[model samples]
Target: MYQSKYPQNFPENFLWGGATAANQIEGAWNLDGKGLTTAEVVAKAENRKKMSMDAVNEAVLATAIADQTAINYPKRRGIDFYHHYAEDIKLFAEMGFKVFRFSIAWARIFPNGDDQHPNEAGLKFYDQVLDELEKYQIEPLITLSHYEMPLALTKKYNGWADRRTIAAFTNYTKTVFKRYGKRVKYWLTFNEINTGTWGFHATGALDQDSTKNEQLQLRYQALHHQLIASALATKQLHQLCPMSKMGCMLARMQTYPATPNPVDVQAAQVADQKNLFFTDVQARGEYPNFMNRYFAEHGIKITMHPTDQQILAANPVDFVSFSYYMTTVTQANQDGTAVGNMATGGRNPYLQESAWGWQIDPIGLRITLNEMWDRYQKPLFVVENGLGALDKLVNGKIHDIYRINYLRQHIQQMKEAISDGVHLMGYTMWGPIDLISFSTSEMSKRYGFIYVDQDDQGNGSLRRIRKDSFYWYQKVIDSNGENLI
Candidate 1:
């Protein structure tokens, strides 16, 4: 059993805030010269099990792009944050948010991946968003790309699988860096860049008809391109902003052995290495030997430019940020699998699960923090951590005590990690306002302090109501993690 620790306090300059992705929050997909994106074609699914790359393949994408009115793509109509950002930001300010992490939709800015110039209207939208954050004196941590790449890129160059996408991505990054470099001090090159290891959705690479081995090759190649692009962007940001910091984002999947057996421990160690490889390359400026051996054994080859290693070595990320929703168990010969956000592993009998069957292990977070800090020796930021629950509104008020308990426990573990000599930078909950769920495309699996009036079918007045966790989090921020009662 885990023992509770006292003196649970956060750093005086610790950043307390919330995070949202453009593809999951900002609607008006085609407005203000915005072009279609990979996210816009993702049709609504009943649950994560029903969601697959089949809905995002070349044929389906062509059909959706040709006739946008045919299917009700939920992501295309997020929480309508394009029209409600100001109102939502006001609510965040009311919650005493010290920072706000959001992404700039690449398709919105470039319209097409190969565009020579950025869309002024897209830039203007973020300008207004920054202005609102500035009004509240809230720091902005912006993600340059967050799964919503231009659909044209996937069509034209097969997304990041081709080297041309690297040039296109760098162009987009340079544009944003030159425009908002002075205003925004913190930036992330990509959202969960490690997701490319398992799925093509994160990279926007369409390979629906390829063999299993072929798909694996493409995924790794695209990941390499993204790493190079991230490095190039980091280099340019250093040149343009000089005072700003660039971070790499990963979906941290902390793995534990289901039993004390040596095989189970070894399996867990390998699983952990897979999850940590992204940060290793980004923070340490080189690929770990384990990954190189794994790739060779798996017959995966990565094509790289002569200068790629130099660029990556010369420009590593300034900090490491990741989303930690839950932990997974690894058993050497177990058939039981546990579901989670962007990860799956053997089920552990000890941990409780969420509504979506995601195992909740708050202690895993502290362990992950200590391991990451000890390994990278870099400032670590918890960019996305929250519990997704089905919130109900009664009398126009949401009493989400479960959400409060979830956050409180996790925040306590974070404090424990801070006490464990971790150089923690900040903690930004998954979201401040309820938005579309990324995996299931359901609005019901909500993780927010402020609830949005919408449903799975996307019908509601779109009213924002503060849940019970809203007030609780407000106190947490105001007291800087000291008043958890």
Candidate 2:
């Protein structure tokens, strides 16, 4: 008995699409005006061990200029998206994508950290890419800043922890917004702005050796800079292009309590507080009372300037968007028995897991939609949602039944949310075609309906083949919600 239901058919303008990021898909790490990003010096894997900032600094200082060349990580040219985007877009068109979500490489635009002007070559690259999408009548949704940041900024300015980095980010966003406002109607200010909380190793916002109190402060300060930059960018977009849709995107892992205990309830509450603290500011333009108390209890304080507060107040976002993948269960540590959340839940027994140990909970998608709608009241978009697995190709055909099942279940829950009046805008699966993995930085954990002939060793024909799920998803998009159930 399902309580939630989707539309018999999606809205006429319902945006059915797929998404990817520049650094994850567009591999040309340093070619054609692209500069070295923070990811260059970092180790190849995403959640594995990290490159020490001190080590990176010493290595850079001791080496000659050539030594400073972009460190070619394994995924820098994943699937060769930089060169094969044209063919890829045609493939996307074949799938009947009404909208396509992707990001521009920040390093490609502003080679160094503090460049006042964007490289013409970099701008022209996107111009051509956008032109291609337009030819296919695919609406482009662009993210201004994804996970990648200029390596120089982190090395010199200490990433988002420094107040000056916010100014530089705003400058970069403004340069692009003014240039591509016409063709690009949907723009996200930041990709997963709250990732700095748990993603300290990759994001470079948190101090690894700092106390828990210090980590909280670093996260708060980093969030402040991102919110200010987002506000500044939104304000500029309003002036330049009034019809554009500007929103904040966050990686949302829906959380649930493992048992009906007070401690488990507390665990879920704390998880929400930690993740939504950034979203609350962006969507509501004010901090939640619980978040204020959370910070006070942790003895963390953010030093915000007067102008920063003004900027946030003047430029609130138009909508909220988030990526939903899995749900984590929190249990009370009674007698210090045990406790685990999604990020740390290794081989969880209470629920099924994905290829990378992520918990599977389809109903969590509906819960996430309701939570966000109740909190923000602005239109919400599911910017990223999909399952990652090891897809096998056989007999000249790839049968990805696991992927189809995952989407069918998730889409059913989404329909229920829409039927209940969540004011949802659209849904864009994470990777429409097989690409590199984000967390492990491995090619094995594939998340696309279209199978690409590549491996973690970076060897394959680089050919693209349509998996069985591709046709299934096409019908889902065509029938909207009617065909999914």
Best by lDDT: 1
lDDT of 2: 0.76
Predicted candidate 1 versus true structure: per-residue lDDT over 290-386, tens digit per residue: 9988898778998888888888899999999999988888889767454654467877788898877888888999999999999999999999999
Quick one: best TM-score, which candidate? 1
The CA lDDT of each predicted structure is: 0.87, 0.76
* Regions of model 2 farther than 4 Å from truth: 1-8, 46-72, 199-206, 334-342, 345-350
- How high a TM-score does candidate 1 get? 0.96
How well does each candidate superpose onto the true structure, as a TM-score?
Answer: 0.96, 0.90
Backbone clashes under 3 angstroms, per model: 0, 5
Q: Which stretches of candidate 1 lie over 4 Å from their true place?
A: 1-8, 48-50, 53-55, 334-336
Candidate 2 — which pairs collide? 5-415, 5-416, 6-415, 27-76, 27-77
Model 2 C-alpha lDDT per residue in residues 1-485, reported as the tens digit of each score: 35565554456787899999887788777688787765445434543222222223344432522454323355566778888889999988888898899988777889886787888888888998898999999999999887777867776766788889877887888788888998889999888877766544335453656676877788678767778878888999999899998988987866676667878888877877778877888877766677777778888797888777777777889989999887766566533221222253222366686756667778889999998898889999998988888778798798888888898998888878887778888888989988866665667778898888888777789898989888988888777657863
How good is model 2 by TM-score?
0.90
